[model samples]
Target: MLSLHANVYAHPEGAATGPRRELRGLPLPTLVGPGGGPPPFLQVLPVTFEQMQAALAELPRCDCEPDGFFLLTGHTPEGVFWRLNGHMQEYQPEDADGPSMHRIELNGECPVASLDAVLRTIGWPKAQLAFELVREGVTLIEADFREYASQPATEGEPRRPDRGASRVPAPCRGRDDAALGTSALEANASYTPWHITFGTYGTRLHGDRRPTVDLEHNEYGTPYLPRNELRRRRAEDTLTGPPVHLSAEQRRLIERLLPEICHRGGWRIHTAAAQSDHVHVICDVRSEVHGEKVRRLIKRWLSEALNEKWPDPNRLRWWAVQGSNKAIKDESYLQNAIAYVEKQRTASR
Candidate 1:
């Protein structure tokens, strides 16, 4: 049976069940295969930026061996950030600039369990990174081929079959409607586009990038900490801060991948923007698709696609080990997200 330790609160006098009770647990169960087979050995490789680029290039010709898959992660630099407090604090343009983009350490025990779960917790910066890696990985495996049409015969007399036999040439039908009767096909005469545009991401101006390190705080509360203590706490949290300027090449890559990702997840992208360090997307929940699944889909797809030509799985290694799924149940939150995405212009603007 699957079980773990439960924390039961006791009275100050030592009697049980007086104040609080919390539940915690050890590893629950080895939920792997149905009945239980051998413990699955998941092969994990941490790829670097140059390595990832190489992997992406080589991916086109390489064969994907059975029982093998990989995860991609990327990271930003660390630093201190000062907030803009209305007009009282002068917001300098230089403050908008931070550090150059680079990969973070991915070894040791990952804080989260899986790549998909980590994305949901931290939001889109990590998701964008994972998406970039997965796209390259995917490209390595499959070519993005455009649909081609057959040309009419250059010169030929339309051959007539033996009419006495009673066989007739069939009427042309849409690929999907070929099996339908002529009467049914006539009832639905409108032509529908073969592919749908569920979402998009791009910058209007050339080289426009977006800033990261957004700050939001509760306005209702004023903490009573002494001046020195407050500064000390903030300093402690300053390590591994946000990234500064991101390359235009990185931004463009994300723009191409987001829409493709939405299509793969069976979800519609209401709006999307590829910023310097983070990406913003306003998407509707596909009844069948959840956030965590979307995160994984993007990560794996981008990594594989990029790695195809680059042959380096580690170029864009910013994702956390695990990503989480978040549900947007309210319309207001969706609106705000969309607005935010629309306003993201790089410092140059």
Candidate 2:
């Protein structure tokens, strides 16, 4: 069972349920992660001014005041983020400008977690890319209405990142879509796009397929038809066989090998779980290939792994021909995904 502890960080909406939680004035917990972790101590690092400005500018654009306080979670190029052990206090900008010359530390009071250790966990070479600035259950990207005030290119680097540059992609969203809680592929987008496909051969099909993650009223508010389409389709199907069920051993093998496949493909597997008929993996895909291609690549890998172990030449179709691939654009969306997949895995066990 998961522990029942209050999340010190934002719930991925980037805000709290009712009260606006602030770590700025409060004292932090004594311990960090599992076991005896880094004592919240002061750790300093270098940051480019342009980088810092681009990062902080999200505050005002989102209508958040620049109080110099927010959760600075480090997102790995893998598309996952870990909270800093401590809070960042206020720091005055240098009267004169230069490159990579700023490290903000809180009052001598609270110690911070080791960012180096966090980076090591994610293995992203660039520390700056991991900066996911969230305040009040909101990511700063929403406020990115315009580019940061144009700045002089420094150290021969472009004032802004180049195309396909590894940075937190801003929310190119409208309030209507946000109100609808649309999928990231439709709205809140990061550079890493995930295209999940559901194959129909080996799973139960409904008469009417609905666009939803779980319940009818999902974050995206997707709707499905009322009629039973699966039954009708089954009656007419001529080529595909019934849904394929994975054995306990097969599921375990997939859970283990699936991540390795994603990693080798330059993707980061954040949340992965498998069941008898299907598998769910939440990852930050690095490839620019079409989502269908991604789905096929994964299915092929799974087939190879399963066939290598079980060797069933007669078995042709594994996954359904269609599945939903959600774009994890927001922290809350990601949280919901992790919970949805992990929760079922726990229940089945």
Candidate 3:
């Protein structure tokens, strides 16, 4: 079973506009075929509050109470089901008296076959879906499924909402192709891996000339900036702390700690290298685990280990907050990334 979280906004023209209604612990059931088989792929099943309530009562209960709506897509003969649990929160739009916006925070699981169908059922355009997965709140592992479009949509099928009609602003539309493209380096789904690169805190390289927070530069490649100017700026800026230089022993310690960290996280490390001021890794994680979360876990665990080993008087900073995470699209890209990390040497400058 794959776990997913989603934030869906209801369009003002098509959504409920009266006082908020609370329907906790509802079971939303999907429409079934004449023979009681699973609903056809991409079929929109209208979910009601009462059905959600009923479904909630029948399903196994956890400690947390269901605080939102539910949608059942289909059921398999093997006793498996595709379901969505959504918690509704109301927000006021820019116009004070305008129709209230409903933001549903959804969490649930389904068979992998239902992923593309569920997304298409939600009526989000492909571009918006990709952008939200990569840069939106809580990077999603399911975002990798953006490649699912390779499968043709059911022909002559009319698009419909999984629940109710809701129009959302198309934020990712009109963006460059590169921005919307899947980070997965390969077209094949099974072999995808992530290539990550991060820098130690206070480390400055001559090539690190781009402004840190520029999302546009990140979407496209960074523009040309003079190496001399970047180095000069680094010398003049007092805020950027001194560059970190790990000793031979420190590097050895990192090599030992990284594999341990990866093992604890259930991630398979393909290759990992710790340079004087930076680190590079290529690893495979659960399809549901996003790169950002994995990067954070590694940074946290290693920082803890390093701090315990060397207690500093002044707080010893370990890593830069942001890192490069590129999905390995194919075997060729994966091999190249692994080679790059393994063969990298300390910069001469």
Top TM-score model: 3
TM-score list, all predictions: 0.31, 0.39, 0.41
Q: Give the distance in Å from residue 278's predicted Cα in candidate 3 to where it truly belongs.
A: 0.5
Candidate 3: Cα lDDT at 16 = 19
> Per-residue lDDT tens digits of candidate 1, residues 198-275?
111111111123211111210112222233544444543532322233356655666677777756544566666555
Q: lDDT scores for all predictions? A: 0.29, 0.39, 0.47
**Between candidates 1 and 2, the lDDT winner:** 2
The residue ranges of model 2 lying beyond 4 angstroms of the native Cα positions read 1-190, 193-200, 206-222, 229-236, 287-290, 346-349
For model 1, the stretches where C-alpha displacement exceeds 4 angstroms are 1-246, 309-318, 322-325, 345-349
Off by over 4 Å in 3: 1-191, 205-241, 345-349
State the local distance difference test value for candidate 3.
0.47
lDDT of 3 by residue, 185-285 (tens): 33443433787667776564434564332123222245533456756465447333355677666777887778777767666779888887778778886
Better of 1 and 2 by TM-score: 2
lDDT, candidate 3, at 49: 30
Over the stretch 29-53, how does candidate 2's per-residue lDDT look in tens digits? 2222223221112212344334443
Candidate 2 accuracy as lDDT: 0.39
Model 1 earns a TM-score of 0.31
